[model samples]
Target chain A: MKTSNKSVNQEAKNSFSIKGYFLRHIQVCLASLGRICRSPVSSLMTIAVIAISLALPAGMHVLIKNIEYVTSGWDGAAQISLFIKKGTTEEKVVNLKNQIELMGQIDKTEYISPTSALEEFKRLSGFGQALDALDKNPLPAVIVISPGIEASSPQQLNQLVESLQDNPIVDHAQLDMQWVKRLYSIMDIINRGVMIVGALLALAVILITGNTIRLDIQNRHDEILITKLIGATNSFIRRPFLYTGILYGLLGGIIASVLIGLSIGLLSDSVSKLSSLYSSGFELKGLGVDGTFTLIAGSTALGFAGSWVAVGKHLGKIEPS
Target chain B: MIRFDNTTKRYSEGHEALSSISFDLNEGEMSFLTGHSGAGKSTLLKLIACIERPTRGQVVVNGVNISKLRKSKIPYLRRNIGIIFQNHQLLFDRTVFDNIALPLVIQGLPHREIGRRVRAALDKVNLLGKEKLYPVTLSGGEQQRVGIARAVVHKPPIILADEPTGNLDPELSAEIMHLFEQFNQVGVCILIASHDIDLLNKMNKRIITLQQGKIIYDGHEMAPKSYHNHENIQ
Candidate 1:
């Protein structure tokens, strides 16, 4: 009988301890949740800030990705113009044009005779009578050179032009490839700038979440004191807060993603119209899966990290007192 | 069981909050920690609760020196002890039933069990009918009762009450003290911190006094003669 009673008491104690274990978690979560529910205004405000901060970087990220995706194929449009001096002979110009055509780097070359250039300029400029007064045609023969895809870079074309400049017949050789290089460089710089700004804003989102969590910990100061006194471990106390952070992060991330998608959707039509106007058949595209996934993971990580930082700092000082 | 062995807690700038504090509360033994506001009574309680770490020495509770326990272990230890505060610290935002149900919920009890336990605890505090009421709507005394109900809802083996009746009238104070005594009768070791000398005189429980971060008395019923100068503690 003694042993049986003892065993029963032990079982009761075990049951009580197990019950206690489960109850603590529910208590902390409900407490934080109740606080959130009570102040819907503040909670919403915080969430909005988080979402907006997240949206800035997320939007920029999507835009950069789309721009990169659309432009990757067209980045190699290198053009070269072989300029001749005003006094160059038409026969020598033809000879040089033929030489460039036979080179492996040349795809297509068009020769403009001095007489044909003078007539074409007059016809296009609507100034045909003014050119008739000149005793000698002042125009120089030129070659419109198209560099093959293999020799698409500015350096390659520059080298080609320099080699041509050494010829006695060619007075001057100029390649109009600066525009392509300049455009590509500007786009590259802009993309990098967007990424840097995105990273900084992402950090800001995390800090915002952390600050919010810290306030939460402070608001529950009484409960925290009680919990600490009761022998609640710091991790146990921090768990629900961590969970809150993750939830905030995830919700904000989802919101940010939606916001980016909506912004893109709103602009996609206008962009397509504009692209069509430019005759490029371009559309303002949205980010693909790889980019979207990156945004989601980054946003979620920001939220989790924000809450974790807040929990870590606040929980540290919540000793029983 | 708890034992404070030469435990001393000093502030960051060397202000001593507790000095060489040593005491032991065994299984089922009830006591009261009474002193003035700065008598280190609350600090002693905080040390026991592991809310504040001891700057020096050891605080062993349930065979673990809480001073040496990792942050993760505090909650597990807290599960074994219950705490009630002067603020009644009941979340005014929630219903009384939910407040009382907190500790049990922390233990992750099923919904039905939580409902049952909350009902039982509310009944003990005589606030059964007011279970759905918010703390803000309750009287000061009723709020304290709600706090008490929350403390005992999980049936923790040890309870620490910090000025449980500091805000109540004499009649309500007696009522609250009676509730603590009843829990004590049931083998739940109770330690109350208060400056209620008149009430302490009425209850025949052990009284431990603190004066300038030092223990001046450990009387069975009232303040020891040596603790006469420490009545200013709140």
Candidate 2:
């Protein structure tokens, strides 16, 4: 009997010390979730505000990513144009093209003879009759060298152009990098703007969650007092509120993901049409798995932080007086 | 199990709620604190529960000098104490069982254990079948009995009640006092604050009467029950 009693005591102690902690947390977590569900209208209103706040920034980020994707295909336009010297032999032009192609920075080199260059220019410039007036072609044989994607930055392109200009057979080498630089600068500005807006919206989410929790604490004033009187620790009283905040954050993140998906679906057709008109195959991209996960995790953390602040500020003010 | 040594509690408003009050109630002892309204009965009980700190001297419970206890340690101290209020502060939103199980839940007891103990406490208070009912639906006396069940559910060593029978009729008040007596029989020290002279006379327990923040009487020996009744009438 003594041995059995001792074992029973040990079992009780172990259960209370280890499993009891997790049990209490799980109970509170579910209880807070149930409380939110009991008041669906109010809970949804809070969640909707949080979702819109999260969706605005998340949508802008996805838009920026898609814009970057579309612009990446235009990188080939920043090619370097090398004008061969007049009276250069065809064999020498061919040799120059072979040498430029062998260089790692040059992706491909196209050799345009003077005859084809003049013909293309006449066709594009609408000066065929005038060009026919001249006996010899005045256009130089040109070699358009497209740089490798890795070497397409403005500085890399400038360096490649300068080195080609040093060639004795090249008259002038030009790179149309102005537009590329302008596009990158615009993207940078927009990215910075998105960051600022995201930060402001995140703060809004925190404030909204905090205010909701504060009202909840007020509504449960007597409950808190009675709980405190019965010997509840500050952490014990704060657990349910913290769980409530986290639930709000989690639901908000899920709704934001859905909203982003809906908006993407709505705009995808228009985006594809516009791209097809531009003769490009760009498609709108939605928030992928990683993005959704990050959004939910981030919003949950924000919720925890918001409730931490509110609980810290309010729970202490309530005593058993 | 509880002691007070020249304890004084002065509010910030310059009113002394308890002054130089001293008493000792041993383990398994049951006592009554009686006086007119605002005569320091509630304040004395609050000091024992550490809800209000004594402005001077020591207030001790279970051998701990609660006057010097840390804020974080107060909860642990209170876990060994059960307090019932005059208003029977029950959460109307929860069922009677949930209300009674609160202290055990705070202590992180197992679910099955909490249910067993809550029912046992309810049985003790004769409120066993009303576990699922909300407090608002219960009568005033029944509600106070639920409060009593909640206080003793955790089986704390000390039980302090401040006018727990204030709203109950004479019969219901006797039933509540009988529950306190039953708890005292099991080695729980009890201190009930009230001004019910007739009830106190019938209990014949130690009665500590306070007048204007000072103890005027502190024993069961009475100078003629009629004289005490006359004093109350005056």
Find the candidate with the highest TM-score and give its number.
2
Query: Which parts of model 2 are misplaced by more than 4 Å?
Result: A1-16, A82-96, A111-142, A153-174, B223-234
Candidate 2 residues B1-234, lDDT tens each?
Answer: 899999999999999998899999999999999887888888888888788999998888876787777787677778779999899999999999999999999888888999999999999988889999999999999899889899999998999999989988999999899999999999999999987778888998998888789888889864245436646687
TM-score of chain A considered alone, across all candidate predictions? 0.65, 0.80
Deviation in angstroms for B222 in model 2?
A: 3.5
- Judge the docking of candidate 2 as incorrect, acceptable, medium or high: acceptable
Candidate with best DockQ: 2
RMSD of each: 7.6, 4.9
For model 2, which pairs clash?
none
Q: Chain B TM-score for each model?
A: 0.95, 0.95
Candidate 1 chain A weakest lDDT stretch, 10 residues = A1-10
User: Candidate 1 residues B1-234, lDDT tens each?
Assistant: 778899899989888989998888877777888777787888888887777889999887656677666565556667677889898877766799878877765555677989998998889989989998899998999999988888888898889899988988999999999898889889888888988888888888788888789887886856775455434442
Note the DockQ of each predicted structure.
0.29, 0.40
